[model samples]
Target: MSKVDVYDVHLVETVASTTDVKPLPLATIDIRVPLPDELIHLSLEEQDSLERHIVRKMDRRLMPIIIVMFWLNILDRNSIANAKIAGLPKDLNMNNAQYNTCLLIFYVGYVITQLPSNAILPMVRPSIYIPLVTCAWGLMSMAQGFLHDFQSIMVVRFFIGVLEGPFFPGVIFLLSCWYKKEELIKRIAFLYAGNILSSCFGGLIAAGIIGGMEGVAGYAAWRWLFIIEGLVTVAVGILAMFLFPDYPRTTRWLTKEEGLFAEWRLSNEVAGIIDEDSSGIWWGVSEALRDPLTYLFTFMQMMLTTGQSFTYFLPSIIKTLGYNNTITLLLTAPPYAVAFLGSVALAYSSSKRKEFCMHICFPLTISVIGNILAMIVHGTGARYFAIFLMAFGVYVVYNVNYAWVSSSIPRPQAKRAASLAIINLMSGGATHFYTSYLFPDNDAPRYYMGGSALTVAVFLCAMTAITIRFYLARLNKKIDAAGGDAEAALRANKGHTETMKAFRYQLHWWTWPLPKALGTEVISIYHTSSKSADAAKIGKSNFIATSTEKWAEKHSRTLETILCTFFKNGTQLEEYILMLDVGGIMVYVEIPESALPPLPPGLITGNNFAPRESNTASKKEVLQMFKLKTDQKIKSWVEEVPMENCIEAVEKL
Candidate 1:
């Protein structure tokens, strides 16, 4: 009655010789059907995308506070060097040799407790821990003003060194936890710049305090410098208790959503970038110990810190140039000022470029050149240029090197913590022997002992930089190879969950996901039950268009292209799908009655699916859908299970 129209397509043939029409079977068993997209795992190109999603939201406020705190801390600790030039040695009655012993004793107490103190950091809040240490050191520094004899100076200095040892390493660890690995070097350099600025700040403070040579309440100007600066440090330390945030997860300053977001971002960033096998507390220590570069870093730090010991007496060294005490203190500012500006410039560029080795090496070479000039030059102007070079060269590498420490060991927070402690211990201990003897008032104008040692240290440090560069290059190559291997492995055992777990345990934490080459997916497979296996590898790729190299490449690949190409070539999407995670639910794509059968449900006819940019409604929708699907599957699966099988279901899930 209604034309009896057929909606289905059929192959028809007209009989040439007969009026009888044969009705052929409408469906054929041999008919080919496209596999349902539902049955086929739908993966997302999320390596770089996820990275950006996490990195974009990092809080920048902590950076300024941390930088300022460390800046003032270093300034106060090293200012004693400047005070000596303003006649602290004369007022304390410290002789040329007794003064050397005083410097030496400081390291004794400093070196012994470094490791122990660092171990205790996680147990106490940094806000409380750092400020308490600051208060203790402030008191010690204040007490330094009261020392009238060599023994008193020696005792006070030793205690000062002991308390100060934990501060730098503690700060480094805290920074590492908050920033992504790629973002860390620059931030670390910024914080370390405080050490550079301290040089200038110390000179300025000394110039103001000791310039007039007036006694404070019967105390010498040198004594007044310690008391006043110490009191200021104590007050700031108390304030920091209120200002400093706890760990990223517990920061009360941020909204609850913000805190969770921060943790999630870091987790995503670090997922494939680190060794899955190398997490937990013990793993950090083992990883740090196993890496030969850690010791090399130690050596680099030793050489650097040995040269830095000379920083304290720079004003005294300048005074030997025939300037009165006040002029010497004033003159100290220019070279140190040059250092602060130069280091910030170099550090900013170096971090921005993500080039650690060359940037650091350049400064070490410059430092060597500076020291050589200081020793060889006869003219006063040339010698002063040498000092400027010395200050600038040292500061440039100082921040870069600390960044190196944080970046090198990507786990068990303990390794980062321990290595930092070791660096400080070696630095402080080395200072005990090297810094005191070089600047004897006897050597005054030309500190041959000090100059020679600094020169040697600079040369050694340059060599150390070369070694580190070679090692990182090799390590980077290994990491690249591992990425390929990881992808291939993922493809070989698709749909298998246990294999993913094994893979996770075998890989390193900071190694990011492999690219679309050698069988790894260019897109991450959602709902695959193996996410945790590769979660440790998350931050392994370039996440931010602002920071990473592969951001554009990741963005250009569409979902349709990825699936069509993967199916056509059968090469497997090994690189992109870092892991498939099994969770509380699974998606079951539904097929409408009018849609094609034989093909599984939810098969799109067109190849038009594309990768979505981060923060898009599409991406958010996908995540939400996946979550809903997960919950639905879990509920259905549980509902079907018998009560007797409940334990088995829980175990399987």
Candidate 2:
């Protein structure tokens, strides 16, 4: 359903002269015309009150559900490192090179399909699409336990990557629509932090499973971990279908008022207009293409991902330390724990300040330092500290960038979806190339190539963040300049009236007085289609603009007989009140308040006006209501003859 907006004008006048040219009090200008209603009926203050309430409600109802499910998903899928150390590769006949190939293949499919899947998501229902995707990936991951050869494992992993493409992008888009940019960063960080937490706990969980459940059901402990974790993922995915919130407009749990407020609040915060007309998927993508910021965003994300490759193979890197399979897996948890702490702190700082470039750049610099240290050091003690730094430095930036993307591109639903997909896909595609190559077994005990590549990636990431920071600042400057242009146009119109005062003429009955202090009288004009002088008179036809300039020129003379204008609160109303010039000098007399009609219940003085006359009202009230105020007070009041049309007035003048 649609609503119509009623914009009423309120007029107040102070009579200066009550002599021969008496312009009676113009108590109000209330035009009850219809416009599309795009917001809730509440005032700004009410909306703010309700917004705070709804925000809390949504956070409580939705945040925990999304966080836990995402946390579980990250833990299960990302623990491939743990499995590698647990002897699964040997038992499954997988060589180190073949394992790398399987990992790379997963990303190959994951990277290629990211954009297309995100684009089509809304077509499949978000609730259905996300859960279905999750379940499919989970099933494939579980099947890893049964694979006996490299070919089978690679196929499963590839399919897993394809199905998982939408999870991060989809959730990011969801958060973008639900929260304002500043409010969304921490949430995105919370979600990304799950990846770090997974890194920390994957080994701990794997350690227990491998030690206690190795021979359960005649299956190896690694296989048990795969099957158990995979089945859990499938179950959670199914449950998520029931628990997940769909598109904001379609969510049934919210009240009608709540939903409308939610939609309008976000729209006001982001676009300054509500887009109930928009869609959820490709809007992000389309916005991405048109928005120059997306490219800068792409650069930031690419750099962060490059530095992040270290966490991806962290378990394998640890196994080279010569610990037994269980101990290596156990040892993996501590560095990940440190990384998790680093990421959460960085995310919190970035979100709180809404300063993405600084937060991301700082951590990336640290990662670069860590990578360099790792490259130069060889001692077990020194090298171990570098290893911890690798996770800590990389995770901080990775966590911050996800939040940044979710916040940056807003609206035209398709473009947002596309932008997120493109960013994610690019990151995945890079993983297949640079990230996979960094960990060749030949590097062995040192892994010099991996460390150096990470160092370069960190440096590049920092540079990209700095560049984007400046770009956003420049765009803001352009927006300010555009606003200034609009203000200048209004001021120019006001100056025209001041300079051309002698040419202005006023019909005695309609013209009102201006206060002495307010300077020269200036009013804007609108072209109306209706020919009636008192469109505000009893049951007269209303006017709509045909061609604004042509209508303005045509109606200029008659408008002197009918129209007048003044600023209610300085120049703020200059945009709304349309006027015509008769003579520059006009007099307005304020009538007693008792003479005006009572105001309506919802009306507020100064904000909502009560027009003195209505349908079939007295002619005196009609004339009084039409009189507008200007710069000087009227010394006298007069009821001059009303001309039938502007043509007659032009001839008389």
Best by lDDT: 2
Model 1 lDDT, residue 515, Cα = 23
Task: Give each model a TM-score.
Answer: 0.67, 0.68
Model 1 lDDT tens row, 1-653: 00001111111110001001211111100111332233223123332343345445444557776777777677767767777766777877877787667767777877877777776666568878888888888888899888787778888888988887777778888777777565776787778777777767777777888865467588788888888888888887888788777666677676554555455444444332321223445445554555576688889888888777677678777766778877887787788678777777876776554566677778878888888888888788888999988877877778777776676654446666766777767765755576667777777677788888988987788788888777655444333334324234433433111111101211111222212211223333322223323322332111112123443245432222111111212222232221112111111121222322232222222222223211112222333444665677632111357889989978986
* Total backbone clashes of candidate 1, pairs 3 or more residues apart or in separate chains: 39
- What are the RMSD figures for all models against the true structure? 18.5, 16.9
Candidate 2 C-alpha lDDT tens digits along 1-653: 00001011222211111122323233233221111164425543354477788788778766766776677667665767678767778887887778777778888778767788878765557777888888888888899888887788888888888887778777777777777666776777777777777767778888899888988888988888888888888998999888778766677677777777677656544324343334555445555665566676776677778887776677777777667777878888887788778878887776544466777767677677778877788776777788888778778777677766665554545776788888878875655565777887788777888887788877887887777666544433332334323234323433111111101110011222221112212222223223233332212223434235454345332222222232122221111212223231222222222333333443333223223321222323433333432233434332355666756756765
Estimate the lDDT of model 1: 0.58
> Where is the poorest 10-residue window by lDDT in model 2?
499-508
